[model samples]
Target: MSTIIEQNQSNIITDNGLFPSNEVMLDLKNLKKVYPTPKGDYVVLEDLNLQIRKEEFVTIIGHSGCGKTTMLSMIAGLNPISGGRISVLGKQIKGPGPDRGVIFQAPSLMPWMTALQNVLLGVNQVFPHATKAQRNDIAKYYLQKVGLEDAFNKRASDLSQGMQQRVGIARAFAIKPKVLLLDEPFGMLDSLTRGELQDILIEIWNKEKITAVMITHDVDEAIFLADRVVMMTSGPKAKIGDILDIEFERPRTRKSVLEHDDYYKYRKHLIDFLEH
Candidate 1:
């Protein structure tokens, strides 16, 4: 049976929620992804493994079609692994669960639902045992946390793409998931709005201390948000090229990220890998 261990080794709980092990939050071992096509079989990811410590923010960068999203999906349990092993919070991922929440390339809000309702759905589903009033309070708390209070009752269609993404972010975070799997969370936003949300996201992460894994093609974004950045090579079987430690001062501002001496050094390394 899988064991669940907190980072400190003091709060170990089992998979059944009793005996948590002291394992890292995420552990991927010799992970691989392959596909069977009529032409034969094509490998998309080759022996890709990653580990994430609790409360650490990690960003993944790669070329288009480089299996970055595929890797994220595997970690989120949205798709099955073709080979190897993955465990989150001491348990092997069997499928999607409340422990893992995903914000995809798009906001993916239900057009028919209001912003409040969209955010409400996740909490309600995950915390069914809680009282109606308890869930309501939790849902609204997260909605306002993302600055969507003014549009709380408005339909999702009424919100701009960036605003819709706020709801998605609120919803994913509302459950207090141990893992936040962000696949280009701000990819669709305008540059100004994207920058705004980046600050907000960092603030929330600091407060919540959630373990976050983000997939982005933007090197700057990776440097700004990640404690570590993992770069992947081009596909036909993409694999990790290099792992970088951001090593910036805590509570990093955008200016700090841009001004840091090693900022461009790491950025260039990622750019060289992607540009080549």
Candidate 2:
């Protein structure tokens, strides 16, 4: 159902007309990041390049300080680039915009606001021209999709950590962003909760088909959720070390993926990279 086209240092995964089209949605060229300190300039990333195609899910993995989060922040326009450019659909990113929705490790919701109200915050910004009823519907729709139908009216402070994160997921998608940026969105939860959230995320992504980029350290999680697993070398000048194409069929379940012949092969390869 998908084809892997190997590029210079990256792999492009394309479906056979399942998505709208096989086009580059996110492009990073000669990307660099630096922090000027009194001692000297500290470089975080240099000459990092990657292209994420439409409807593709790419996960980045690396050792602790490999600039994975830095790169992701640049794409989200939350951080400034020291050099090069990152573009979405041919347009260069200047700053944070509605087209890209970011979900960080923390839910970062306002304690005073209810779950539905938190979702409405972004919906209101993105759909200002739409009627209030339409915006409310959009917010409610995503909340239900994330299995927060009963918690819609609950204040964020009153909800469990997992429930708060569900609200975060709902808020990010409610904006209908063209690209979703996830920085260990489930890192704070228990293994069971994390797995449940992963399934929920993939289910939503299957239907939305939004281009996604995630930063994760979990090897199995990276393989299960990604079309391509990007491995980054150790920092303080991290660059992509290698890219692995995951050829698993879509509508993937944990059991099906784990049972696949190549699953452990992929796992071993990732483990080898991380250990070495």
Candidate 3:
């Protein structure tokens, strides 16, 4: 069985109605992915194993064509694993569920919908039992948290890319998902905007304690946001290369983190890994 212990270790029931437990939030055991091609089977990932504790922020980094995003897709139930298993809170993932929320490279907002409406769409679907006022409050609270309070009424087509991404982030969080899957969510943004969104994401993660798995190519961003930085080998058959535990204390700032000795050490290590 994937679950080591299924009993409730804590009495806290989250707003999403899940009883938080002292257990691994996500577990991937011997996970593999393969695609059949005209040439033959193309292996993307194999013999991969990883475990994330409850509320942990883990980032996967590698060059293009690595299976980092594929791993996230499997965990999100968007793709089927050809081998092994993925378990969330000890239960195997079957398909897309409200327990997992995803933010992609593009905001993917509805052009005709206002920012608030776009956010409300996901919130309502995930929380159909919630009162209208309650759902409205949830939408407003998350939008404000992402610094999009003033853009509530603006249509998605009218908003800047950064603002639209803010709406995407708000929509993802409003659902109160136990796990947040980010596939290069800020990859298309400029450095300044990406940094801003990174800080906002950190604040939300800190507040909500949602387990997060983000795939990124940016070393600095990975160090800044992740509890553990997981590097993957370049793939025809990719697997974890190394795992680096970030020791920076919570409420981390870019300036303070950049000044730390271990920060540079970890950076150099990651660079060396990617180089050879």
Best by TM-score: 2
lDDT of 3: 0.89
Could you tell me every candidate's TM-score relative to the true structure?
0.90, 0.93, 0.91
lDDT of each: 0.86, 0.90, 0.89
How far off is residue 53 in model 2, in Å? 0.3
Per-residue accuracy of model 3 over 14-35 as CA lDDT, tens digit each: 3233334346688788899999
lDDT by residue for model 1 (3-113), tens: 222334465543434223444688776889989999999999988767787788999998889999999999999989999888987678998887999998899999999
Locate the minimum summed-lDDT window of 10 residues in model 3. 13-22
**Candidate 2 weakest lDDT stretch, 10 residues:** 13-22
lDDT of 2: 0.90
As a whole number from 0 to 100, the lDDT of residue 116 in candidate 3 is 94
Provide C-alpha RMSD values for all models, in order. 5.1, 4.3, 5.6
> lDDT tens string, model 2, 56-83?
9999999988999999999999999999
Q: List clashing residue pairs in candidate 1.
A: 4-20, 4-21, 5-21, 5-22, 12-20, 13-19, 13-20, 14-19, 14-20
Residue 181 of model 3 has an lDDT of 95
How much is 49 displaced in model 1, in angstroms? 1.4
